[model samples]
Each structure stands twice: as C-alpha cells, then as structure tokens.
Target: MNSVVTRRNLLKLGLIAGTSLIAPRLFAQAHTNTQEIFITNLHTGETDRVLFYDQGYYLADGLDRLAWLLRDHRRNEVGGMDPKLYHLLFSLQQRYGQQKPIQIISGYRSQATNQWLQKNSDGVAKVSQHTFGQAVDFRIPKVDTQELFDVCCSYRQGGVGRYLSSRFVHIDTAGVRHWG
Candidate 1:
C-alpha cells in the first residue's frame, strides 16, 4: 500500500514523535507538580492526553483543548471549565495510576441542553454543575463503577454520584456529598 504523506499527516507524525521524545522528561518532572490526564469523550469519540498543569500553573492552551474535547456535543458549545474540576480528574487518574483514558459520558452542558435533559430525565438536576463546567460523568475502561465511586468518595472534595445502571460516576466541584 502506498502511504501518501500529506502536510497534515506529517504534522501529526511530528507531534507524535515530539510527544514521545519529551514524555520521559515530562514524567520525570512529575514530582514538580506536573499534572496530566488522558480523556476521551464517549459522546463524540474525541480524545486527548494533555499536560495541563506545571509547577502550580494551569496551561491555557491545554485547558482550552480539554474544554474543546469536553464540550457539549449536543449543542456544540465550549464553556469555561473550572480548573478544580480538572484537578479532581487528575487526582482520580493519579490515584488509580491507569494508562487508559477516562471515558467521559458527559461534560459541559449548555443551558438549552440542560433544560432539555431536565425535561426529559427523571433525575438530572435542574441546577447541574455541568452547566458551569464544574462536573463530569466518567468511567475508566475495565474498572468497576463501585470501586470508582468509592475512590471518588474517599477524596471528599466534591459531590459524587454513582449511577450503577449507566456505569458512570459523576463528580462535581460542589460541596462534598454522595448520592446514587
């Protein structure tokens, strides 16, 4: 098979190579507060492994990329994502030390989308943290939902919702609480 190397493909290859080359150095500096996470939005099949924090600073471009990946798929809107939410995800990933991406069932929600969901759903909150980009419904691949919920609740940093039927745990940057 003939593989044509277009400019786009070349750029992609370069990015992959560059990331691989620097990954060792990046991970080496993980002790210096380098926070990274891999996320895959299940709704849109969008994914990225972003290094969002370094030495107590959140990288703007990385955060934007994450928000883009985590945007409202229904309405195609990108909201301002709270940094604390990213921290929560980072902590979860670090605790489990998983290589698989966090599969996001839901992320930011536009007001219209939230209201539509509220109207159609029985348990979706009328004032959801998702509207403010402060919550995420996600699950790790091959990881049990009960274990995920327990780990999240252990932090006691935010609201945790365990949806057993859906097999996703919702963590929000609201006051500490848990509900199934």
Candidate 2:
C-alpha cells in the first residue's frame, strides 16, 4: 500500500533540504573569531594592527595616538578606542566579507577637531562620543553604505549611528541611544 505524504511534511522537508544545501557554504566562510586590521595615523606617521577578538578588539600602543600626535604638537587628540567599538566594527566588516580595508574618516577627535566640526556641521552633537574616545567615523569604500548600516544595526552592540547624508557611520560604545 502507498502512503500519502502530508503538505506540512513536504514543506518541512524542502526547507531542511534548502538549509542543508546552503549551510555548508555559509559555515565554510563563517566569520572568523578574530580579525586583524592595519591602521595608519596619517598625521603621526605611525602604523599598527588592530586585532579584533571574540569579545572585542585590542588597541595596541602604536594604535594609540596620544604619543604620536603629541610629538607633532598637532591639535589632534588620539586615544585607544573602546573594545566594544572594535567588535562592532568587526561585525560590520564581516558582513562585507571582503578583504578591502576600512577607511577611517575620523576616529579619536581632539577638542580642536571637535570645535571645528561643531562650527562646520549643524549635525555635529555638542556632547559627542569623540570626547571620551568612544566614537569612530569610518567607511568601507567598495561596500554599499546602506548595507553597512543594516549590518551594524543588526549587532546592536552599542550605538550604531548611520549617517547616510554624510556617507559615514558613527559607532560608539556609549550606553545611550542615538541613531540617524
């Protein structure tokens, strides 16, 4: 005797098959537990690797800008970024899945730069995250801006501010919430 298959069972079988087919490729290229990034202090002429680990990334001395910027006596204030920020950035990078490095428009901001931004842009927050070395402004040249924002939003690690108007996203570890 032939048995009749239920519609629900067929749908379930199809979904399982589809997932099984796609799962391997996804797992093969899954996000690495750690990611390595090279950062250049254009002002200070220094270079360092920013390593992103599971919980967050580590900011090395070379990555820190206070020493470099202080040497040049520039009005730029540089400090090690919060680890949460790095993790957030890493997650965003993973979504892109491209080896293309991220371009930082601005990372740590000195009081002078903050003042300049305040005067220049109406959108600049008076009490910005830069004051505490918690904010990062960056862009991935070859990646889609909207796609980047969407990925960042997914993590909800901290504060993911999408600045489509300015074409750079602002990421911070601030517990406070603000996004555009």
- Identify the leading candidate in terms of TM-score: 1
Q: Pick the candidate with the highest lDDT.
A: 1
Task: Report lDDT (CA) for all predictions.
Answer: 0.90, 0.62
**Candidate 1 structure quality by residue, lDDT tens digits, 1-180:** 235557779889999999999997887676359889999999898888998888868899999999998899998999988888888898888777659899999999999999999999878999999999999999998889999999999989889999999899999988999999
- Model 1 reaches what TM-score against the true structure? 0.80
Clashing pairs in 1: none
Query: Model 1, 50: alpha-carbon shift in Å?
Result: 0.7
Candidate 2: give the clashing pairs: none
